[model samples]
Target chain A: MEEKPVRLDPWASAVKLEYDKLFRYFGIKPFQEVLPRVSQVFGDPLHLMRRGVIFGHRDYDKILEAYKSGERVALVTGFMPSGKFHFGHKMVADQIIYYQKLGFEIFIVIADAEAYAVRKLDRKKVIEIGLYEYVANLIALGLEKNKHTHIYFQTNYEKPYYRLIQMFSRKITMAEMEAIYGDLEPGKVVAALTQAADILHPQLEYFGGFKYVVVPVGADQDPHIRFTRDIADRFENELGLRRPASTYHRFQTGLDGNKMSSSRPDYTIFLSDPVDVAVRKLKRALTGGRATVEEQRRLGGVPENCTIYEFYVYHLLQDDRELARIYSECKEGRLLCGPDKQYAAELLAKFLEEHQRRLEKARDRVLDYVEPPEF
Target chain B: MEEKPVRLDPWASAVKLEYDKLFRYFGIKPFQEVLPRVSQVFGDPLHLMRRGVIFGHRDYDKILEAYKSGERVALVTGFMPSGKFHFGHKMVADQIIYYQKLGFEIFIVIADAEAYAVRKLDRKKVIEIGLYEYVANLIALGLEKNKHTHIYFQTNYEKPYYRLIQMFSRKITMAEMEAIYGDLEPGKVVAALTQAADILHPQLEYFGGFKYVVVPVGADQDPHIRFTRDIADRFENELGLRRPASTYHRFQTGLDGNKMSSSRPDYTIFLSDPVDVAVRKLKRALTGGRATVEEQRRLGGVPENCTIYEFYVYHLLQDDRELARIYSECKEGRLLCGPDKQYAAELLAKFLEEHQRRLEKARDRVLDYVEPPEF
Candidate 1:
């Protein structure tokens, strides 16, 4: 059978995907191949890496090599400040905090410009969300405020960084941009070039000199990664820019088994969601259970397609042995949906209660971390 | 006979025109209508305005009203540093100095980014030309170093200026941009928005406060002026931007009677050109002398078509009485091309010698005026 072609769009709210196609068609190597080296180089890999949540990569091997050699490496990522910060965003924050602990310099861009232009969000509202929601949540999640950790609103950045966007425009053609992004508009063109600058500015001499850069993004953002890599190659000799390494994580599935997004608030859980509210949502999530108890006992359960199990694997259960025991119990039909949901709810409630307390304090510290843009 | 359609292209190097189409089709009012008012409002008018060289305007009456009412007013213009600063650029420098002397705030943009991205000039060379040629010529032409006079390289501007470009993109569509500028590319899109920002940024609260703005440009730049006016209207409530008033001048005719440009070295005189070399080029200029001298005296020469007469009107002589004498003498065929060329060369040589002396000191003072981008 002939396979359908895949096209990734960074701007899409919910992207349906066959993740394996990323490895086969887009030259993204299976990230599992480098899992062992990650443990050896960084001394116990991130939970996402170990559990295979970060399922694919472009040049993560180079990132590992740079880490092992004690070379300067930086992690770059961005959040579109169009909505509330949710668990899907936390998944990225986890990767960023993990890299920061491993001594990678962090550059976080709050994409207020993209949110206002492409997403048509209110400018003042976008800036408010970027600060109180995104930056505050990252701080609550233990994003350190060191000299190496730099967070900036896209509109309020340094001159050299904006210069990169202007220089990159000369090398790429419109047809090439249209291929990755379906249609063109002035906003999208500027946003795309701005994104390239976000990913590659660490290598410019004006931005601290050269460093190996890696971007941790969702699978749907590969188009931006591919476009940025092409730009890096074209400017290799002139700007001394190298292709940025990237690892693509699978989307955090919503309670309804769709992609988790702030736009779908009913199924998604915000980090600041009240304890009872978050727990109630989790209790109603679809799980891996059969219709009849007799049938469930006879044919076990399918944890592979379960949203409840995904939450435990991605966030709640970090111990390998405990997570494995739960997996086996579900597979053997020993743990029913009702009892398993109750346990997941308790853990989720505890996590939200503690996070909210820290988030309250974090809100007051956002200005100390990054200055918001003045309208 | 039917009139041909007119399309103004800001990117094209040479544009042919029948000037009346701008007034009839594009709604550009004749500057002559406001000439007496300029003399009444700001004192003796500029030579260019008096001689009808600055032939058209859009909302210039508003600018005069703002100035007369003791409201803040600013003059904005740009120089694309693709090559040397020729007499064509000095014309703009003259207007800038004229406004500065009138106590109007001045904002001069060194379009280094546009030169690199649109003209495909070397980045380093563009910066060099912007400093040594463009900025130096403005300084030599007596652009005062006052608080009101601000100069900047496009790539190295402030955060709010770049922010305006980002926000402006939201309201404009690709189809709209392509309508004004045919066949779009990434660089041109950014350049167009950047130009709008250049003209309108003086009114932004972050730049200073709201001020009445006027741009002096050649006829080919009408597209940018029109585009910026539309942007100003769209952002009127949000950004508090008023549409900038503008006056359009006829392009300086080259010695060969084409558009005078830095790209056409033999026909265009650079402010930095050695006295002898500039005079040699001027001596070989095309003229309006009749085919036979006997016929020239009977049917007077057409001063309207003579390049030598243009030099006398545009530069060389600022006195209206002396310029009118030369025009009538040439029209009566009493002055042949040979003697006229010698007189114009002497004037050209004298201007270049004195200007080059000031230019030597001006080049050393460029850093005080504006900062260039570090690549």
Candidate 2:
């Protein structure tokens, strides 16, 4: 048998697949290989890394090695301010905050330029969302404001950062860019170069000298990671740039068992969603329950296919023993879907209620975190 | 007869054609239509405009009206720092200095980014040439340093200037870009957008509010002029931008009667060339004289097709009477190629000697005029 290559589109709204293909075809190492090392280097692994949510990596071991040697390391990531901040975004935020806690420098980009250019969103609306939604949520989720943490809007960054985009364009071809991002438009070309700058710029001397960089992204964003790595290689001699390490996490499944996205509001839960509205969406979520109560009790529930079980594993429940308890009960057919829905809804409602309070305060402090573009 | 559309490549060095076709095929109006108006609005016109060396225009009448009304108007132009400063670049500098004398704000861009990306020049070398060669020569040509005069490296400009590049890409398509530029690459796409930004950014609110802008370019660069005008139209509502007025000038003929370019050192003369070498090259220049002395005496020389006549008209003799005397003498076969070459060389040596003296003092003032990018 021959292995088939997989193509991933970072701009696509829905991306669902077996992630093992990333290892077999794309050379992404399984994150589990470094999970124990992460625990040894830092005090504890991020929940996402420990529980297999961060499923794969490319050179993440190098990031761990740099950290262990007491060398500087930075985590870089970006958010498109096209919609409300959802649970899928929180997965990325968790890794960022985790890295910051481990004393890694953090660089967060509000991708307002990408939203306006690629998504055709209004510039004012994009900036507004970038502030009130993305930056605010990150702050509420424990992204601290300190010298080690730097956040900026893409359109309002430093000159050298923009220079990287212009300089990187020299070595890469339109064909190579099209191979990673389908269909070439002027907007997509600029946006792709801008994204590469966003990832690799932390190492530039203008951005406080070179530091080992690691980006935490969803599996679909591996294409951008791959493209940026190539750019770093091309510029290594000219700019003293090195390829950044990256880890790919699985997407948070939607309520109906599809990909969770802010575009699909009915199936996605936002950090800002009202308590009752969120619970309503959660109660109706698809589960691993059989057609009937009797059938579920006889066949044993398939937690692997359950959205509610995924919520507990990915977000709601943090204690491994408790998550395991729920897993075995559901697997043995002792727990029913109705009670599981009610329980999961209670946990989600509690998290959102507390988060909304902090988000309200975070909204007032967005300017302290990042400066928006003047225009 | 139906007229055929003409396609132009700005990157191509050699551009030769009948100037009337520009009026017939493109919307560029004969500059002669605005010649008398230039004298009325800004006192005496530049020698280039007076002698029809600047032969075509788009919306130049609007620039005259703005100047007459005492409204803010600016002259924006750029130089690719891939080579030494030559007479072709000096022609552009004359227009910038001419506009500055009329109290028009000056915006000169050293296209270091374009040189590095499109021409693959070294970063340090590009910056060095941009500072010592481009900026120093402009200062020596009497470019004043004041609040109204702004010179910048394309890679080292402010945030909003770069923001315009990102925003302009949104409304343009690859096919539309390819129509203007022959084949598309990442470098070319980025360079095009950066060029558009360079032309239009003076009107942005971030750059001291809006001002009427005029760019003086060689005839081959009309493609960029047209593309920038289209961008200004698309961004009118969003960015409060208006189309810039522009003037088209004939390229200085090389010694061999081809396009004068720095790439052909034997034919093109650099401003920094030693007097002896410059004179030696000039002595070997092709002329429009008859094959034999008896034939030249009977049938007058073709002064219209002569490179030596072009030098007097473009640079050495600014007086209308002196230029007319040379033109008639050459046409009536009174001035032979040998003596004409000696006269032109003496004039060239004297000019280069005086210019190089000022150039030494101007080199020290380049840092005061523009800040070079730190790589």
Candidate 2 TM-score, C-alpha based: 0.95
Can you write out model 2's per-residue Cα lDDT over B1-375, one digit (the tens) per residue? 132221211111222356767878889998878999998998999998887888889999999999999899999999999899999889999999999999999999999999999999999999999999999999988888989999999999999999989998899999999999889999999999999999999998888889999999888899999999999999999989999999999889899999889899999888999999999988888888999988886676766677887788789888888777776676667888889889999999999999999999999999999988888
What C-alpha lDDT, on a 0 to 100 scale, does residue B74 get in candidate 2? 96
> Every model's DockQ, to 2 decimals?
0.75, 0.79
Q: Deviation in angstroms for A280 in model 1?
A: 1.2
lDDT, residue B242, candidate 1: 94
Which numbered prediction scores highest in DockQ against the true structure? 2
The global Cα lDDT (0 to 1) of model 1 is 0.87
RMSD per prediction, one decimal? 5.9, 6.0
Window of ten residues with lowest summed lDDT in model 2 chain A: A6-15
Error of 1 at B25 (Å): 1.3
> What DockQ class does candidate 1 belong to?
medium
For residues B1-375, what per-residue lDDT tens digits would candidate 1 score against the true structure?
132222221111221256888888999998889989998899999988877788899999999999999999999999898889888887888899999999999999999888888888999999999999889889998988988889999999999999998999899999999998899889999999999999999998887899999999998889889999999999999999999999999889899999888778999988888898898899888888899988787666766788888888789998777777777676666877788889899888888888999999999999999888876
Best by lDDT: 2
